[model samples]
Target: MSMNSHAAIAPSLLARIGAPVRRRAAFLLLMASLGLGVLREAALGDAWRRPVRAEFRRVLREAAGGGFSTIAVTAALIGLGLVSQAIYWLGEAGQEGIVGTVLVTVLVRELAPVLVGFVLLGRSGMVAIVELGAMQAGGQLRALQGMGLDPFRLLVLPRVAAFAVTGFTLGIIFVLIALLTGFVAGSLLGVVQLSLFGFLDAVLRAMGARDFLLFPGKLVMIGALVGLTSTITGLSARRGDSTATLLPRGFLRGVLAVLLCSALLSLAV
Candidate 1:
């Protein structure tokens, strides 16, 4: 081939190779931008106008209040299984003194956020997807746009904020319930002799300043990601999509996003 022909083919070949990379990069950037936009709108008092506040209150109620029993039950089971097991094994190993640290580091710091994120995603995130997906599919989004409403500000922000708030609330409840249940179970089994106050004090003492900040941060971030991923997945649906297709995709993305956010936060700290 001539040098000019070689140059032409090389550029075309490079472009072909870079196509997927470019697309992936663009998707990541878009997600990051949307996340920031949510944060910015959340910070603004004007974003809490009556309609937005009403929607936010409704979602928060549905996501957090409606799911309280389930969260409590799950936390109890986690306490019975994980906490009891940990107490037993640690006691047997003569490492009982470190029970609080272990629980703080493993159960509260890590598992609580992840499990709460999953719960929120399964309970509320899927609802957001189905609701938004139906609207998008039925052309309601177009109607809203025609009426001069910004869908992101109206629909997306409130829902995402609800998820974040619910995540934090549920996470704290999960940790407390799990620990309390574990304490009860441990006492019944003769595995834990410490008073409730002593047990909690130990755990609190083991937590560092960073843990105080990072634990809640993880919950909030995971919640926000769950909301954001579900909303994006639903809103991006085509005319051909239905709830059947949207549910599994949104669930998978929400799970991956929760885990990704948790991992990233851990790495950051």
Candidate 2:
């Protein structure tokens, strides 16, 4: 075939391949756009007016409150399992001196953020997907626009911001509870001789500057992206999309976002 024929055939072939590819590409494109535009949208004069503020508050409460107990339980379980084992083994190996460093690196820098991200994703992110997706499918978003409301401003901004804030707050809570629980468990198991304060101090001192900066930032950004992916997935729902279709996609996308963000951020620091 001539080069021109090849070029012509390429377009036709691509057209056939584009449907599934384009849907994914569009979802990613929108997710990125929404993540970037959130702050800009929040800055708009009308973005955080009474209605938007109310929604933000409501979402913040729901996302944080719903996951609070889950985060606690998960953190405690991790403490009893991962943290206690690390402490016991390190003590056995006469590496108790590095306990802080290991825990900080594994728990704070890595496990806490990803685990907390999952907690937020499962607890509140799915809820947003369902609610927003239903609105999109029902044309309620367009209906709100027809009534002179900016759906992005009223809905997207508040929810995304709420999720971000909640992410950071819950992350701190998770770390503290996990560390405390682990200390208690270790002390009871006769594996840890250090006082609670000493253990906390050790963990704190083990933290380098990057840990302080990157960990919280990662959690915040992860939270924001969780909300972003969920909202975009939901808002992009096709007319006939049911929860069955929207949910799995939302979950997959959200999980991908969290893991990718965590990996990249860890690498960066």
Candidate 3:
């Protein structure tokens, strides 16, 4: 190909290549705007009317309903693998004094939020994607709009709030279970000699004032991000989108949101 011919074709090639990139960027910006809109609407008391309240309650139940068993199982496993192992190794190293520090810093502060976020994403986020994607595909969203309903107010706000609440709830449960399980395992293995109250005291002592604020805040943010990203993914579904496409997209986005929020919070604190 001559240089002149190549130049003529380059623009067309570039346009084609850039189209998807631009579309993705624009979609991300739209989602960000929608997230902000949800936050704003949720802040207003008037937005918590009967319909919105009902939907919020239903979504909350559906999202967090079976959370106890899942959290318990996951927490026990994590305690066996993470907490017990850390305590045993630290005790062997004669650095048992810092067990609290290590647990708080590594497991409670970091792992708990991320793990709980993933649980919520798997348990409820994918459901949101499927439900909303189906509604979008079936034109139910349009029908609701025609019926003078604001989908964002009715759907997005409550769901996001529920997710946030669920995230915090699960996160706390996760921390307690993991810690207690770890303590029990450690005691059984002869790695922990302290009483349960003493072990808890050590963990509490290791935590600073900032940690009290940061831990819960991290959980809330992780949950909100997962919920927001998944919801946005579903709501943005087009006519061509199906379960296969929406599910993976929502999962990836939710995972990224959870990690990113955790990292940012870690850096900030």
TM-score of 1: 0.91
Error of 3 at 80 (Å): 0.7
Give candidate 3's TM-score: 0.95
Q: Encode model 1's per-residue lDDT on 120-211: one tens digit a residue.
A: 99999999999999899889999999999889888999998999999999999999999999989999999886899998998899899989
Where does candidate 2 clash, by residue pair? Answer: none
**Regions of candidate 3 where Cα sits further than 4 Å from its true position:** none
Question: Candidate 1: misplaced stretches above 4 Å?
Answer: 1-23
Off by over 4 Å in 2: 1-13, 16-18, 44-46
Task: Score candidate 2 by lDDT.
Answer: 0.91
Ranking of all candidate structures by their TM-score, best first? 3, 2, 1
C-alpha lDDT score of every prediction, in listed order: 0.90, 0.91, 0.90
Q: For candidate 2, write residues 1-269 as lDDT tens digits.
A: 79999999999999989988998888788787887799788677866799999999999999999999999999999999888999999999999999999999999999999998899998999999999988987889989999999898888999999999999999999999888888888999999989888999999999999999999999999999999988888888887898999989889999999999999999988
State model 1's lDDT: 0.90
lDDT per residue for candidate 3 within 73-191, as digits (tens), equals 99999999999999999999999899999999998789999999999999999999999999888899999999999998988888899999999999989999999999999999998
